[model samples]
Target: MVNNSRTNPSSDTISYLELLQEILNKKNNLLGFAGVGLVLGLLIVFTTPKEYQSSSFILLEPEGNVNSFGQMGTLAGLAGINISQLPTSQMALTSDIFPDVIHSRDFLIEISKEEFEFESKSGQIQTLGDYYFKQRPGNIVKKTINYIISIPGIVSGWFAKSDPLPSILAKSDEDQSDYLKLTSQELIAIGELKKRILLEQKGKLVHLNVEMPEPLIAAKVNTMVLERLIDYVTAYKVGRQQRNVEFIEQRVKETEQKFNEAQMRLASFRDSNQGLISQSARTREEQLQFEFN
Candidate 1:
């Protein structure tokens, strides 16, 4: 009975070994796939394009009434007007108007046509069509295979496919526009050029640091953005001031008209009553003179 048990165990062990050998034999078929995968990965890494970087910095300064108002709290409080309610500090550093100005469609449209030229060799031109069109032919092939494989199954919906190149390019361009739109929409977008932007605020000081893929563009954008911001702020302030001036001028004109009418009425009253009191006094003086004669 012991020998019978031992014989049965030996047969089971042989069956397990045979299964292990079959798996090893199948692994040989996968070796070719693994080699191809490695080569494709290396090609992708080596051929991928690289981007350059550039940057600029801006230091925020207090402007207009905010600056005066802050000083008034410290030095002009004894002059009978309390300016403590005004938020000079907050106003100076406020970013409330920046996002709108930066992201305005007009502003984005202005920079959209700025040139972004890259060099290409004659040899590169020959391969450009193949790189853009044919290199990813497997994408279409895989989609077609998936569609065919699905037949009438539940996965048929997932396998719906179109020509890969046009769809891929369209998607890529759309993504690029989306990215540009985000930047064009806000002054803070300058900081989104990868990790090239830095915002620093210390005490009353605010600094905006922007980095780009080109040096001149970095400087240009930094300068232009700040200048535009200042211009917008100044124009807004001037517009407010002009409106106030108009209101004040209108009030002054109304007050002047009322004053002139009151003055004319008083003068007419004096003119009409001028002789009555004077005539009475003159008659009394004549009677006193006759008595003296």
Candidate 2:
């Protein structure tokens, strides 16, 4: 026997019409809450600082014949083909290392020191270090986020023993390599910059994106990074070629010295034994000729 009942307490639930009517009754409360949310959103939007972004393509494509590398990704569209893995006749520095080059400590430090006329609410010329370190001037939202994120570090700092970072200049390392001792200002500036600058490889094109709180700074930094990247790569290529040339020149000089020595020995033997017909002299001439050749 099957038992069917309309009143099942286990599965009791309201219908769609009942739910709609209940929502309608509370519409005034919902509207009030929405109004408050709208006001808060508008306040945050208007008060919060705006970040401007500027982008430029990196010039790393190969030219003429070999233009299909990872950097020169013109021919990488082929299905499941990795050019870097393939054995090629050309050995070159590709765009892969560019990210590392730009993010290098020296490169970042240099960029931090570059003075620019920063325009936010007020206009003033200062280095990137001064602007960010002195006045990262964080908003309420940023402050809350930073506080949350830094809780662990703050707790650790209490237990740990370390010197406070100096405002002007601080040692980067204990053992002293004279390698990029950063100021507290630069430390903050670099931290900010790391977030703002990005290198992305998209198919055949490599691009640089820079973001700043100000419009002009964004554009300026984008241009600066591009110029510096090109310069660094050019210098590396030129230096490699120069070393190769120097090696070849040194080899040529040594060969010339050997040739001259052989010639002199041959000439001296001929001068001393002129017209002296003997197997020893003839054998000696043959030996000298072999050596000279």
| Best-fitting candidate, scored by lDDT | 2
Tens-place lDDT per residue, model 1, 1-293, is: 35543358888889999999998998877888899888777765665444333333445555655333344344333333344443333434265445555656555444433443323322232221123222322343454665687677756657977555787788887788645444322332322331343445555554555554345455655666567667877777666545544544555566566656666655565566566678765565455444333
Whose TM-score is greatest here? 2
Can you list the residue pairs that collide in candidate 1? Answer: 54-212, 55-211, 103-185
- lDDT, residue 118, candidate 2: 67
Candidate 1 worst ten-residue window by lDDT: 125-134
Q: On residues 1-293, what C-alpha lDDT tens digit does candidate 2 reach at each position?
A: 99886775544455666788999999999999999988767866776778899999855556323242333332332222443443342466678777888887788888988988866636778888777787675565666778899899889988998778775445544546765677767777778888888999887789899988888889998999999989997887676555544544555567668879999999999999998999999999999999888
lDDT comparing candidate 1 with the true structure:
0.51
TM-score of 2: 0.67
**TM, every model:** 0.42, 0.67
* Whole-model Cα lDDT of every candidate shown, in order: 0.51, 0.75
